[model samples]
Target chain A: MNAKEIIARRVARELKNGDVVNLGIGLPTLIPNFLPSGITIIVQSENGFLGLGPLCDEPNPSLVNAGGEPCGIVAGAAFFDSAMSFALIRGGHVDVSVLGALQVDSLGNLANWMVPGKRVPGMGGAMDLTTGARHVIIAMEHCTKDGSAKILTNCTLPLTCSGKVQTIVTEMALFRINNGLVLEELCPGVSIADVRNCTEADFTVSPNCIATPGELI
Target chain B: MNKCMSLHEVKAVFRDGMTIMCGGFLGVGSPEGLVRELMSNGAKNLTLISNDSAFPDSGIGQLIANKRVTRLIASHIGTNPETGRQMIAKELEVILVPQGTLAERIRCGGAGLGGVLTETGVGTLVEEGKIKLTANSIKYLVELPLRADIALIKAKRADRAGNLVYEKAGRNFNPLMALAADLVIVEVDELVDCGEIDPETVITPGVVIDKIVVSGGY
Candidate 1:
């Protein structure tokens, strides 16, 4: 599997049965395909609906997701206006929100909304998802394209939310944020040094936390 | 209560520099024909409140592309690069609110509430100028209500009485905008009789609607 697929595959383990999950547009969008068999979760599109299915082969123009992407819905889907839709998210009814992040600090601060000096793409529901979801999981690449660390000691860019991320999933490892980022799991063939070499964030290795994928399930 | 009107009559309701609440998330559920009419109506310096500025070629994107909108209050504008360009150039005043907060603010406006308190964007830049309040040790940003001069909403079905039913996800910000605007103008794909639409499914009651337009071809 590719790096993103590996990251998404591992992130799916963070979910449980009957979870109302909201996946951000990018790497996190790949997670639902990797869920364990017989596990049923209702996916949410921030636009205005629950039970978001896969991308439709022929998508209707008026039925797009929050990212303005065309998507499908399950049979038991429910639709509402944006106000009520977000009430579900902000009311802490969503079980999980898996989002792609640009930067994550040791303190679990997230910076994904915009890069200063670059054209500002508006923050959609990410800030809410980071704040309102019961569990916020950031699923992203371990490093930048040039191979620099994204897990930093402190996020230099503007933060989307401060100290709200609970879990961080990367190609190399999975870190749980409990006061600080705790290195809990490693993907197959990934060593502790591999994560350390790429991460700028100060993280401590868990005493008995070294495990591989499929362990969570 | 004859709420139905011709597209031209709907166009007459718009004036230059009007604040419009357009219901849509990324052009879906947006009042496309009404937006197109607003374009030809030559209403400039418009303020658009919606979920997004959509792609450069569609919905409010056309208005933005034509330089009709001077300010945009929305949750996301990444799908429309033109909006980004204009915002960077300082030609457009863009207020990017979190999606849920934006909805709640609009809801508060229509419901005649003072403001909405939310935990979203509490520690982020969204809190920079806003007043923060704490209750029971929980912090929240108090977002003010956002109301528009007119609301351009698209619905799948509407009775002559102006009761509305929206399509699947096409209903994003429509019902909220309908409630928050001074004049609610709905463009319906199918216009039915007063009793045709079931009461339970009518998302927006006719009492608040001011005008209704038949869905126009783009």
Candidate 2:
């Protein structure tokens, strides 16, 4: 599998039945395609609705997600104004919110909104989702293209939320952000040393850590 | 009372430096007719609040490109590089608010509340200069109510009385904006009679609306 698919599949494993999930744009948006069989989750778009359908070949302008991409809606879906839409979010009704991060640290700090002296995407709803979701997970590639670690001891970019990330899923491994970054599983053909080489943040391997099977179950 | 008006009449009420709340996500639900009227009126030093600074060629971006807005408060401005350029050049003062908090602040302004306490920005730069109060030993940022001199709204359908129904995701910041301004002007798609729209589906009641302009050019 490709890197994004591996990460999305592993992150999909983190989801369960009856989860109302919010997937951030980019890699997090690929999650629904790889959900384990029999797991169903309602999707929430911060722009207004829950029960988001898949992105379409022919998209409608009136039905775009927060990223302004046209998409479909599913059965039993309801649309609302922004105030009530955010009320559900800040009210902690969302079960899990998966977000992409530029950098996630050992302290669970996520910095993805801005990099100083560069173009910044203002925080749309990342702050509320990180602070209010029952479970918050960070999904991103393991490192930059230059082989620099994105999992760091401390974030160098502006933080979306402080100490809010609970899990980190990457192509190399799945990490549980408990006391610190805990290496919970290694991807196929990836060893502890391989993850260590890429990860700048110090971490401990879980005693029961297992390698991802070549085939997704 | 007849609330319908022409673009020229709407422009007459617009003045320089007015704080205007425009309803839209990324231009999907914006009152482009009203926006065009405002631009043509050439109002200056205006404070504009909305969900986003839409693309440079359309929506609120047109206002910014024309050098009308002085201050802007919104959730995101990433899609509009012109807004960033203006902010960087110190021509525009951009205050970024979290989407939920921005909504609740406007909701508070309309609902007669003084402020809203949320943990949305409790540990970040957004907490700067804001009151952080604790209840039950938990801390929250006290976001003050945000009100505007006028609100520009776009509705899919409306009664002559101004009761509104919005379409799909297009309903996004419009309903909230309808409540949070001194003068609420809606640019609607279809304007029916008072009894035409069902009361139960009226997303925004006519009581708060000051004027209506059925969109001339969609």
Q: Candidate 2, residues B1-218: lDDT per residue as tens digits?
A: 99899877888988998999999998888898999999898889999999999999999999998889999999899999999888888899999999999999999999999998898987788899998999989899999999999999999998889899998899998998899999999999898999989899999999999899989942
Over the stretch A1-217, how does candidate 2's per-residue lDDT look in tens digits? 6888888998898898989999998889999999888999999999899889986567877899878888999888899988888888878899999998889999999988876656767898899889899899999999988889999999988888999899998998989888898998888888999999998899989998998777652
Name model 2 segments beyond 4 Å from true.
Answer: A55-58
Best by lDDT: 2
- In the range B61-86, model 1's lDDT, one tens digit per residue, is 98988899999999888888989898
TM-score of chain B of 2: 0.98
For every prediction, compared with the true complex, DockQ reads 0.85, 0.82
Q: Which lDDT value does model 2 have at A171?
A: 91
Estimate candidate 1's alpha-carbon lDDT, on a 0 to 1 scale: 0.88
Q: What would the per-residue lDDT of candidate 1 be over residues A1-217, giving only the tens digit for each residue?
A: 7999888888887789999999998888888898989888999888888998886578887677666678888889999888888889989999999888889998989998898658578789999888889999999999999998999989998999999889999888999999888999888788898889999988999997876745542
lDDT of 2: 0.90
